[model samples]
Target: MSKLVFQSVAVNTDPMTQPTPTPALSAPDLTEIQTGRLADPFSLLGPSHRGHAGHLVVHLPDAQRVTAVIDGTAYPLAAQAPGVFAGMIPPGSAYILRVGNGSPENGAQEWEQEDPYRFGPVLGELDEYLIGEGTHQRLWHVLGARVIRHEGVEGTCFALWAPSAQAVAVVGDFNQWDARRAPMRPRGTTGVWELFIPGVAEGASYKYRIIGPDGRELPLKADPIGFGSEHPPQTASVVRSITGYGWRDAAWLEGRAEAQDRRAPMSVYEVHLGSWRKRGDRPLSYVEAATELVDYAVDMGFTHIELMPISEHPFAGSWGYQPVGLYAPTVRHGPPHEFRDLVDAAHARGLGIILDWVPGHFPSDAHGLAQFDGTALYEHADPREGFHPDWNTCIYNFGRREVVNYLTSNALYWLEEYHIDGLRVDAVASMLYRDYSRKAGEWVPNIHGGRENLEAIALLQRVNTLTYGAVPGSMMIAEESTSFPGVSRPVDAGGLGFGFKWNMGWMNDTLRYMEHAPIHRRHHHHLMTFGIDYAFSENFILPISHDEVVHGKGAMIAKMPGDAWEKFANLRAYYGYMWGHPGKKLLFMGCEFAQAHEWNHDAELDWAALSRPENAGIQRLVRDLNTLYRGTPALHARDCEAEGFAWLDGGATDISVFAWARFGGPGDDPVVVIANMTPVERPGWRCAFPQAGHWDEVLNTDAAIYGGGNRGNMGGVVTEAVAHHGHAQSAQITLPPLSTVMFRYRGAE
Candidate 1:
């Protein structure tokens, strides 16, 4: 079998439906690309300067007589002005325009030792950019041309923008670093260097080296908008358009979209594929990863699957945060299209896909966007706008028009190009702060000197607005750790406009309280009520993020108190409480089971933890939690929708049990949830329900399947109820030690 033997199947959302129309890719106009025609320059150039137009106007001053030299043919300028020139030039072609000084008294001049007009703007083919002033021109041709595949052609084209280089050669894993074997030929009039490799196709990595005027050959340069990487010393990745994959998730996307529209409960299983599992030998392909993990998520009953940074990163363990190329999915995991297939497969299984997009910072690797076009193109020029000290990365100048478009284009790229349903913006706090990771002397204040980063804020707001406007179903999630007000609020309503923000404080406080509480006095009366107090502040996702379970913090299951049994019980109780709380939920990999060690990406997740009943119990509890969430509306229906929930009790007997009613008719069943933080089981405890009759146990953290003592109220059975509360009949319920129980009852419905 050949390398290109993979199938190219469209992952349809409707198996019987036709595919959607392809999006448009329009090239810019021609006159906007040329500064002056190479055919005739003497008449076009004035006595003073020569100018070209693209996004910005470049003025070349102190020029004398100008003439066009192309294919050994000369064209004299008609003297449009003394030395200034104006004419049209076609894109994808190159011609030389020479200048020499005339008489000084005649307003003509010659070059001095350090003359500024000695050089002209280098012309190269420009890739279609959707952002910046370049958007106005609509198209550009700088030093390179798009090298597209031709049918039945066993060749490749080398395009570049090196007008000053004496020669350019393509090298890499393909040519064995030999320059002479593949010398680039000059094409038409465009400065583009062209070449065709007879045997090289997709997946064959290659790079280009430019031989300078001094006869020095530089290494291959990474594509400015490449979607993948083999970074630094490594050549640019080979092309593999993602129009290929075997996907089966068409129905899943439709169902999931409907559920999301209905504001249904969503529990996401966040994974870092490389870290999730790795055998000792070769890595698992994307297909294998999808097969292995998709079923696990479905079995666990999670409604969504969130992946960590999957964009191509050079390092194996940077958590995909230090992205070198935004266009390429990490080739380490697999090809670009394989990731799409994985997502499509997941969607087919009723799972929503959320990507971790890091536009806040980029790595400083040579093959990355540190500096492109021989300038600070992708970043700001000064320390005030360019660098991130904490992560040791490069910060994009969001204030710049091109920068805004770059990131905004990136935001739309994943959604439009890869069919991702949502983005979880990482390091939002860093993006929002100018003083982030900076000491007094190191920090650069904004113009107002108020510690506010307006540019970043504007960029985020634009991102949210543009992302939501372009793709209504796509979600904008923020990992903003600080108390950034209105993180989940709409932009027009004086908020940052994120659909959801990670509830870091809630996670930290709850975990701290849970870990410190003694089994006997684990009452944590004050801490247990934290969720109800600020739950309405924003749309939040309670995350047991990878940050919490790594770097010696130990596993979430290990955060529980006491012996193995107690620990399992404690974890179940914690999860049960979190689920019942008024927020959406997300669990990092390895947290589903009670792994013994902190997560290590280089190592496989401790699957052996399942052998331990305590660990297995935690996993079962999570699955049960997902089921319960789907089964009961009282838990998650009110999370993002308008005022769908209210807390009836906050200080109820140092136990912090609360009552909440989901969005439904007034006569619908009201869910009564009770949590006993104290190790004292309130047996035969009477809790007041809104209606009379009996209430069945929907979910119990102490259930036997979840590795508990099986002290649960039987389901589907009716019982007599007694009332102690005002104006309503109540039911008598049994509360297990350090556990939570939820019951639905509405006038015996």
Candidate 2:
């Protein structure tokens, strides 16, 4: 037997009494009714409430007959409208209804009326599915910080932060597109909408029907505060309740609740859901992907899984950065509940989840940010601040208080509501620099007239401050490519206060060296040693991101200048050196197995590449790199600390080599590392370790698993005498031709 939680079940008159309001009810009550399959939570089936009177209505869009078995009493109906019928059931009767076309008709549209609500009756036609307990309390349960609501002349006023729209209106399950029937009045100074629908309360689904100058009616959208939803590109609707979902991870939450700082080394595996896999052709359900990805990352030694934007967007290739619905998770891939299930499942596996949130810009979809609330509800009035000239997208107005609350609140919502571990703010450089894509005359400076965009910075600071305060374990990250100093510093210390910043400079410098130099001749000595100087500016993660491989840029493997075998070997060497270098690491999707072609968002990663031994070897190298990094104290030892790493030597390019040390703690072994970048292999390349005696080869770039020639001194072997400062002391040794060798000191006994 299925579980049912209904406060009170009531029924009214049948369809025969619908044309006129009957003084006496002829329909039977609960004793005469029978129940069919209970609709899923948010199911369009089951009886939907019609206004506040508790009248129930069901729609049969295509039906020659409408038969409802109420307590074993059956009622029949004829098509009164297009594939539709009128219906009024006896109050308090349990119902089992079947509506279908007795004779097949050629695509006729069907609808039903005679009630206050017009809800579609098919459960499977839309994106969301019914789950556990369905209740009014669960409806619109999620609260976002930014919804600007005020008491108005007749009712409460609500507004958003969409500055691009010329006009906006409030439309939903209510009003039926009557412009003046429930027009949202604009708040004079704020460009927000004011309305007072006294009857409208929680669970009353509504959307902003914005009108652009083109005279088109935008589709009704879901309120970001919706407790349960299918999300979008599907139309937003009111969900009654969800029951039976069991949530675990109490122990993890207990530890994370006190302070977010404890959750450090937030290694995130960024993923695009659709492109992550192929389910024969279509994308896998969130449950399927989440289960597999969590297992993969946890086994691979990553702490967190940061999903590329999962917000609702229409385009297939956008990677979820161009969001259409501010609050809704995309319905294109799967239902919202399924997404929640995925997060919950991940939590059960003890893995943290982060979402790549794009609140800085929105797409130009008429149904979304454009003309919302009869104006630019989600953006700014000033064209200079309202547009992203480079991306052809609408820029958000950071100065707006409501806007600030909306975005920051979204950060909090994902963490609190869905148990997301953190957020990686995308395109932060565009948000931080006013003149980023503008010419001298094309931009307006902030009040301070400084290079930094003050408003945007202020918004980011607030977002970080509030989000961190709200959830202590939640991390805030910035994808700021510009040289924004102190971006990851504390807010009280005059910085943006992000937990970490993507080290774009490091990625560029390293990739440039690998692409241009033969092992023998590298021009920029600073390329290898550059990060040490700036590593203290902010906590950084070196990322070989998607931007490196798309839009005609060849694959990372293809970028190496040599024969295919040599190129693979060269690539392995470069990665090995990078792993030993300062800062944590991130590689884009296809880089792991040396994907041959550029990344295509519509297609899956080149899985076929695994068949080739070279490609498989590269993958093995990446796995080893991650494993060794995690196992050793030196690699991530100094992350976010003042005395984490130091370079002993900085000069020389040809046969260039350098030594560095990373300290995890006072008594711990300061991991010593050395690198050689010469085009040809040097048989006995010599370097001296800072410490003396029996230094072991902990990690080698020349290993076969990493696509190298397996030509290197193996680990656990003692280093013999090496010449240093005209003295022979057993010290660290360096290999040749783009190689990095790691060593540990023998105890100081």
List TM-score per model, in order. 0.75, 0.74
The runs of at least 3 residues in candidate 1 whose Cα sits more than 4 Å from the true structure, single-residue gaps closed, are: 1-200, 208-220, 231-235, 244-256, 519-524, 653-668, 716-727, 746-749
Model 1, 1-749: lDDT tens per residue?
01122222222234343222222211221121132212212112212223332111111334545443333343333333333333332222233444446676766642211111112222223442222142312111222222344333333344443444556666656556555435555443433444444345566666666655555544456654455556333547554544445556556545545565435687988998887777675456788877888888999999888989887777767888998767677777777778887787777777788999998999888656665434565688887669988778889888877667667777787886677888999999998888887888776788888777898898889889888887757788999989888888999998999888898888888888888655434366565566656777888888988999888888887788887777777788888888887788999988888787888887888898799877787888889889988777766767765466654455574454544444433444656667666566777766555555666678788888777777756662243444455425555567887687877663454
Q: Provide the global lDDT of candidate 2 against the true structure.
A: 0.61
Determine the C-alpha RMSD for candidate 1 after optimal superposition of all C-alphas.
14.2
Could you give me the TM-score of model 1 versus the true structure?
A: 0.75
Give the alpha carbon lDDT tens digit for every residue of 1-749 in model 2: 01122222233346564333312211332111111111121122124332213134343333466554554454443333343333445554454444444444555432221211222211121111111111112112222112222222112223333333344445555445333234343333333333443334334456665554454545554444433334444555343222235667677777654323421343456677778777878776887877787787777666567788887676666788887655666665665667878888777776777788997898766555654544665677677778788877888878766566666666776776677777889999998887888988777887878767888898888878887787767788899998887888889999998988899888887777777647434566777677777877788887777888888878998888778876886787777777777666677777878899998877888889899988988887777778777666566666656576765545545567666666676666767676666556666555544555566667776676666666666663354566654435444343645567677665543
